[model samples]
Every structure is written in structure tokens, then in C-alpha cells.
Target chain A: MMPTEDIYQPLLNVIEFLGTFAFAISGIRHAAAKRFDWFGGFVCGVAVAIGGGTLRDIMLGVTPFWMTSSIYLICTFMAQMFVIVFARSLKSLDNTWFFFDTLGLALFTVAGLQKTLDCGHAFWVAIIMGTITGSAGGVIRDVLLNNVPVIFQKEIYAMASIIGGLAYWALVELGCDMTISVITAFLLIVAIRILAVKYHISLPVLRGEE
Target chain B: MMPTEDIYQPLLNVIEFLGTFAFAISGIRHAAAKRFDWFGGFVCGVAVAIGGGTLRDIMLGVTPFWMTSSIYLICTFMAQMFVIVFARSLKSLDNTWFFFDTLGLALFTVAGLQKTLDCGHAFWVAIIMGTITGSAGGVIRDVLLNNVPVIFQKEIYAMASIIGGLAYWALVELGCDMTISVITAFLLIVAIRILAVKYHISLPVLRGEE
Candidate 1:
């Protein structure tokens, strides 16, 4: 008999797809701005969409997601085409992209935490994995462009994911249903990130003088 | 008695320093070729020397090496200065650099395999860690430069590390002394990599047209 699916599975799948799409669009927009050709844009988009997850899986001794499904590749291609077709209009939709990007961060954090917990890791390890899944893709993107990672220099980025992971762990400890814990974690991350950006709340950097 | 007073411990420390120096020099040379500023070159050199081990430690749930030791930072700076001061002479010593690079690769593979085994990982997992430790820094360098990884396209690069790892395992199974096993494994990796490069024995890529 096929095992019954968990109630949260469908929601998690939706979150994964949304996160992947947002990351792909971000990469495609950057590539377009750099005047990369279509194939180059597509490659960059795909890398942005799956790079963090691939790193996580390799670390965790699992096959990468794209190796199991072509959905990510197709989504990246669509993202590239969308950017190419809507370059001028996209400039006006900056706020919309920001919203989706935060949503993607939240979803990725939750998914990564859940997956790490499922793999029998401790809560601390799960939190680290969550942060890596949420922020490493953007770090890779910025590094490729020869820019300092936004996460390394800016707004409550990894902190939001860590907070979400802690919340998820606390809820699980309190015996909350898995679905409720996941939703609460995801919402917490999105809310904290948006608030941080709105208030210009940033992490302090050490500007050591030589 | 302090462990550092032990003969093998001192030897290990010497090898570690040499390996790190070689790795840093390679990174500085590459950054100079790309015309990166001094700070950029220093950062790249440090990243190249320590990046693979850092990744390995993260995956293995250990604190990263540079976090434990500041000496690596000083070594990288020295390497950058050495490259800057000797750029013309160093440019004429490609063979010398290649020799040290291969030796660094061998030492890194052995260190990775040993660390993974110490962490109680299986043989296959240890072998994977060995390859990651030997090749990942170079891959990161290429990626940041927007080039496809040479390991993925060139001579038996990672394969040499894998062979070394397998040899280590085989020697362990045959009840060889740990020191002898490690030395033999490192020698095998260095010999195989040098031979592959000298003979131009490259791996065949999967042609896209096919």
C-alpha cells in the first residue's frame, strides 16, 4: 500500500516551487543587466535556483534535487525568458520582486529546517542547514559577480532564518502539530525579514582600521 | 608532555604548513593574473588555502580551521606579498608551482580522508570528503571567475584523490600501520596527478551534440 501523504506535503511543495522561481528570476535579472546571452542567463538562473540545495544535499549525503526532477530546470528557463521579455517593465516591479524574494527566503528556511530534522540531525544542525539553504544561493550569486555577499554586509538576513528555525524547534518541543509549526516558522521568517528591511535594521560590521 | 613535542606531530605540522603555503601561492598567482588588487588577492589566496577544509569541517559538524587558528591568515598574506615581490621570477617557474600544487593536493586528500574517518564516517563517505577537500577550493576559484571548473573538464583530477582514498582504505584493511598507509596514499595521488598532467591524459566529456 502507498503511504498516506502528510497534510503539509502539498504546502511544502508549493513553497519550494515559489522559492525556486524567485531565485531564478533574481539570477536572470542580474544576467540580463550584465548583457549575458539567453543560454548564459538560463545557466545562471538554474544555478541560483538550485545551488544552495545542491550544496546542502551533497553535505548531507543525498542526491541533488534537479537530478531527481526537471521542474527546476524548466522553471529557470521560464524565468530567463520572462526577464528577457519584460526587462523595462521589471524595473517598475522592484517591490514585487522584493516581496517574492522574502517569501522565498522564508519558504527555503522552513523547508531546509524540516529536511534536516527529518534526516535525524539535532536542532542546532537543522538551524545551520536552514540558514545555509536560505542564504547560500545569494552568496554564490554575489561572489560570481565579484561583489561582497549582501548577507555578509546587510539586513537581518541569516538572523531571520535562525529565528525561524528556533521558533520551529520551540513549537515542536511544545508538542504543536508539525503543520502548525511549519506555518508559524515560515510566517515568522517572512515577517521579520520584511520588518527589518522596512526599518533599515542591519547587522553591525567590524570596520577595522588598518 | 605536549603533543607538539612528538616526532610525528612535528612532521605533520611541517607538512601542513608547506601544503597551505603552496595552496596560497597558487591562489595569489591566479588573482594576480586577473589583475585583482592586493586585498582581493589576499582574500582569494586565503580562501583557496582554507576553503576546502572549511567546507569539509562544516559538513562534518566541526568548527572551521581558520576559526581555530589565525596562522592561516598570516600565511596567506605572506603568500600574496611573495607573489607580488617575485612576480617576474615566479612566472618563469610554472613547473615548480605545478610540483607544489600536486603535493598540496595529495596532503589535502589524506587530511580529508583521515578527518572523515576520525568522525566515524563510512569508507565511501570518507572518499567523497577526500575528493571535496582536494578539489573544491579550485572549483570555487573557477566559479567565482565565471569559468567552468577545470576538475569537471580536465585530466584525472578528482579521480586521483579517489584513488588515494581507496588506497588508504585498502591499506587499513590489510592491517598496515596508519603512518605507512597515509604516506603511500599521498604518494599515489601525487604520482597519478603528475603523470596524468604530464601525459595529457584527460577525461572525456559528455558532448552536448550527442
Candidate 2:
């Protein structure tokens, strides 16, 4: 039974690495558009990939991951380098970048939910963490760039993460297989996000007077 | 005894408001430098004054203050308008701004430490929260302006908060009067920060590698 569980761990780790790479790439692309130097681009990529998780861990009183493992840092650096080397070619694939970004966002939400559950938190707390994990890196990225969060202004970003987390919770309550539940949650997030973007769905803004 | 405590509460509330005003002014001054619009300047001012404490409260599973009270928002807007009206004169009084910034940092740190202690956290946790409440606002400010945190790179800013926290903790452990301990801690932070800035005392950088 332990060996069976360990088998999936490697797969999860691979998915995590891929998600990090995709997220870092998105950050690098944004930094390039902002005309940042290589060092600035690298920092932005690393911060966007790890900022949310780092804040979560700090709040939970856990040691931050990047302080213990350099793999995340290395991956971000590679992502930045890749963008720098292939800037012109990558510029033509805006849609592809969006796809990767959405995929990474979904994976991050699932990862955050799983981590919070593993830490023995309640479902509501897990859902909140999932949304934070999915959206906070982007929030920090925008803040560091001196802009309002895109989620606060644009498509249904955090709403998708919330819906995915709820779906995960519902499936778990129904005693679905953990793997299937996780995959379903990821799909729900990606699908909702894609649909929202296509249809331009948005949350009602909190009016100043309200 | 109860009546006395209630009487003092009003005084404490006034002090808190004053501190918040000073902090908002510092933020507004910076926003003026950046030439942000009225709304942007107001948002920045409020964020700089309350951002760290809001984060601390959220992490501690408490309601954020500004969400509970509109006074902070109003104060920030007032600060922004005041700065806009007096931008030219204010720009000439750099020393006055620095002094108010130091005073605001000190008072905010004490307020944070007190809140954490009231929440029944450990001394170390209180110290950490105090430092977070004092310095994290400016970190957010710098990040929002697309710059590295001045505290992280420059003079002993965070160090002042930490030292003040330690002083508060030590005084409490020694059974000093709570009000006296709090006031002493605040004064210590202000003095240390001002002296550090005047003397150009700074932390050694971790140089050598990327």
C-alpha cells in the first residue's frame, strides 16, 4: 500500500515542476513586456512562481520551500533564459502562453487544496488556501509591477479557483477516488477559466459608495 | 477599575488614529512623488498605513480593521488630498516627513505587538508580528512601485522594529507596567530608527553570488 502511494508521488512531483515552469514562463513574458533586465526578469519569474506558496507557508509557520530546495529557483532561471533566447518566436504564440498559464493556475489550486487538507485544515480553510495559492502569485506579480490585480478587474479568476475547490470538496464527500477528484477539480478550474475568458464573465465590482 | 480602563480606551483610540494619519501622510507623500491620480493615491496611502496590520489580522484569522471601520479609508483619502494641495511645500520638508515616518513605524509596531499579545500568542510570535506590522507596509509600498523593499536593502529599519519588540517583551517579563512598557518600546523604535538613518547604519549585504 505504501509503495502504491509512493508511485503516484513521483508523478505529482513532475506535475508540480511543470506547473512551476509554466508559471515562471508567464512571469518572464510579462517582465519582458515591462522591459526589465535579465536579473529583474529572473526575480519576477521566481517571485511569481513561488510568492503565493511562500506566503502560505509563512502564515502556516512552516519553513519556506525555496529556502530548503533550490530546484524551484533553478527552474525559474531556466524559464527566464528560455524566454530571453526565444523572445521573438514566443511572441507569436500568445494563445499558447495563455493555455499554459491557465493550466498552471489550475494545478496550483489543486496543489494548494491538497496541502491545506494534508495540514488537517477544514474544507472551507482548504478552499480559501486553494484560491490564494492559485491567484496570489499573480496578485504579487501585478503589485510588484505597480498595477491592480488582473483578477480584481478582469475575468472570473478567483471564482474559478473557488468553484474548483468546491467541486473537489463535493467529490471527496461523495467518496470519489482521490486521483479522480483531483483531476476533476483541475479540469473544472481550467474549463471555467477558459469559458469565462471567452465569454468575458466578471464579478461585480464593489462600488465606491457601497 | 473598569471605568478607568474604559476611559483609557478612548485615549488609546485617539493615539491609534493619529498614528494612522501619520502613516497615511507618508504614503500620500510617496504617491505624490509618483504622481498617481486621486483614487490611486488614496489607495496607496491606505495600503501603506494598514496593509501590514491587515495581513497580520488575516493570518491570525481575525477581521481586518478597515473592513470593520471606514475611518481608515476616510483618513487615507484626507491624507491624499492634503498632500496634493501642499505637494510643493511638503516636498521641501523632507526631514519632517522622515520624523513622522519613524514615529508612525514605532507606534504601529507597538500596536501590532499589543494585538498579538492580546490574541494570546507567544512572545516570539508577538515580536514577529510587530516587525511585520511596522515594516511590511513599506515593503508592499515599494513592491507596488516596482522596486525592492527599502527595508530589505537599506538602513536598520526592520532591525529597529525587532529591537523595540524585544524591549517590549523584556519589560513585560520583568513585570513592568503595561502602558509604560508599550510607550518605552515605541520610543526605543523611533530613537533607533532616527539614529540609524542619521548615522547611516546599515546591514551588511550577502555579497558574492547571484
Candidate 3:
């Protein structure tokens, strides 16, 4: 009999590819604003697309997924193309980028939690990894774009991931089915991100000493 | 019998710790210039100190050094304390930060090369990883501070690391004593960085479309 991961691996790959593409678009758009050349834009896209997962894999003591697969690079290149082709139209739709970014964040969080569990980490560790996987790429992208990370600012980004992670941890702890727990966490992340954006909700601004 | 690594491990640890502290100070200083709060400064400091090594370790398929050791964190914290206490005094020493930063870069490049060799990677990979270890942290720090990375600017920062890495690779290929190889590469990095600054040497900047 095939292992459970093998059974689910194809679906996971699809989700991951979509997430990577979206993250790449977000990064590429940011790079465009800075007038990065084609190579710089491509590099920025790839960095944002894979940065979080690479970080997660490192912490989990595994070879990075991108090193073993060409798909991610191809997807990021495709994302760059998409941005260039639709630059004018995409610029008009302010929420379009936000939608894809949130969807990617939700999908990545669940995938990260699963990978952490597979690596035999504790629930708390899994939650942290989940949040990192969802949010760290954006942090890297924002940094590359030369701005304060939106997550660290008055944005509910990382906090949404954290909540989803907590929900996943609780579901697993309460002996829920694995699929049910994953779906619940994924939905929670998506919903939280949407609501936060729609409501203009944000974390409190951190005050510096005067 | 103890392994050879054990014999030299303490010395490596000391070098790594000093590099970490210096890197943290550089990061904290940048964050302070941006008016970041204490927590933000601390996070940036930690990121700059550990970011390059973490990325190298990930690419090298090893657990991140900071994850396994509390010493890096402790060193970063001490750097933070030093910054807070000497804020007024340090503000006057324009070149002191550059000196420590260059020393840390040289030390980290050699240490990173040694670790990659221990992992049985090829010489070229070790050289690239060494360059990443020496330069990537400052890139991350610059990004976090919302500025163009100094490495990508006209500065010869990464070039200095690349030169050092090439020297290390050549020495190893020539079957030079490992200690001599490390020392020679370290000094080369420091000398190159100093000369670059003194002579205003830099790479040609890439021009984007007008």
C-alpha cells in the first residue's frame, strides 16, 4: 500500500504551485515599482516565492525543495510574465493582488504545518513553522522593496497565520481527522485575512521612545 | 579519541560569536537610524547577525546554526545592550562600525567555507556559500531598513567576499594547510574591503530603463 503522503502529494503540489505563483506576482509587482531590471525582477520573484518554504525546510533539517525541483523557478518566471502582460490591468484592481496573496498565505500555512508534523516536531513548533511559512516570504519581499514589512506594521498578516496555526494545533490535539483539521485551518486563515482587509483591521502600531 | 573538529571547535565558536556580535551591532545601528523601537531594533539585529548563515545552512541542507545554539541569540542580545548603553558614544565613531562589520564578514566567510567543506560539498559550492555567509546578512538588514542593498549598489562589499572565497577555494585545491588557508582568506577579505573603501572602488551600477 502506498503511504498517505504519496496519495496526497499531487494535490499538495498543485496547491503549492499556485501559492508560489501568487507570491512571485506580489514580489514582481513590488520590484517593478523600484524599476528593477528583468534579472533583478526575476530574482526578487523567486526569492519571495520560495523564501519561506526554504526557511522552513532549513529549520526542519531538510534539503530545500527548490533545489530538487525546477517547477518553482518556472512558476516564478511565469509569474513575472503574467505581471508584465497584465501590468496595466492589474494596477487598476487593487484587491486582485491582495486576494492571491491571502490565498497563498492560507495554503502555505497548512502545507507548512503538515511538513512540520511529518518532521516530528512538537505542536508548538509546528504552529510557529506554519506562521513562518505563510508570512516570512512577504517579509523578505517587503525588505527587498525597501520598506517596513507590512506584517510587522499595522497589518493583520502574521497574526492571521498565527490564529490559523493555533486552530490547527487545537484541532489536531482534539483528535480531529487530519483532512478536517487542515481544511479548518486553511479556511480560518483565508477568512481572517479577508475580514481584516475588508474591515481595515490592523495590529496596534508599535511606539518608539520619543 | 576525540575528532579533529572537537580539537578546534572552541576557537571556531569564539570567532563565530564575535562575528555575530559585530553583525548585530551593525544591524541595530541601521535600525536606530530608521527610528525603530527597541523590539524592532533587536529583531533587526538578530536577523542581520544570523540571516546569512541561516540561508547558507539551508542551502547546504543543514539545520540552521542559530536553531541549534543559544550562543548566537545571546551574542545578539549583548550587542543590543551594548548599543543601548553606548548609543551616544557610538554615534560619534563613524568608522568603528565599518571596521567591526568588515572583520565579521571576513571571519564569517572563512567559517562558512569550513562548514560547507565539512558537509562534503564541492569547492565551488563552498565558495558561493562563503560569499553568501559574508554578505547576505547585510543585504537582509538593508532590505529590512527599506533601503537598496549596499551590496547591489556601487559598493564592492560582496566582491570582497567573492575574492576571499576564491582565495579559500584555490588554497584548498592546492592542498594548503587548512589553518593557513583560513587565515589567508580572512586577511584577504579584510584587506580587499579596506582597500575598496579607501580607494572608492565599486562595481558599475546597472542602469534601468529611463
Highest lDDT scorer:
3
Off by over 4 Å in 3: A1-114, A121-128, A140-148, A159-210, B1-8, B35-43, B77-90, B93-96, B144-146, B154-156, B169-175, B194-210
- Rank list by DockQ: 3, 2, 1
lDDT of 2 by residue, A1-210 (tens): 011266678876776777788788877777888888898888779878998888666654567767998999988988988898888898687787678778878888888788877766667667767887877787777776666555544557778888999999999999998888988998999999899889977654322210
Q: lDDT of model 2 at residue B54?
A: 76
Worst 10 residues of 3 chain B by lDDT: B1-10
The better-scoring model by DockQ among 2 and 3 is 3
Residue B200 lDDT, candidate 2, scale 0-100: 86
Most accurate candidate by TM-score: 3
Listed per candidate, the RMSD to the true structure in angstroms reads 9.6, 9.3, 6.8
TM-score, cand. 3:
0.62
lDDT of 1 at A102: 88
The residue-by-residue lDDT of candidate 1 on A81-104, one tens digit each, is 788788889878888878877888
List iRMS (one decimal) for every candidate.
Answer: 10.4, 10.4, 4.7
lDDT of each: 0.77, 0.76, 0.80
lDDT of 2 by residue, B1-210 (tens): 011256578765665666677778776655555544454455457768888887888767665555445677677767766676676676577686677778778877887888888789999998998888887877776666555677777769889999999998999899998888887998899899988888888989989885
Per-residue alpha-carbon lDDT of candidate 3 for residues A13-46, written as tens digits (9 for 90 to 100): 6666777888998888888999998888898898
lDDT of 1 by residue, B90-182 (tens): 757778777877888898889899888888999899999988888888877665544567788776888999999999999999999888898
Model 1 interface DockQ = 0.06
Judged by DockQ cut-offs, the docking class of candidate 2 is: incorrect
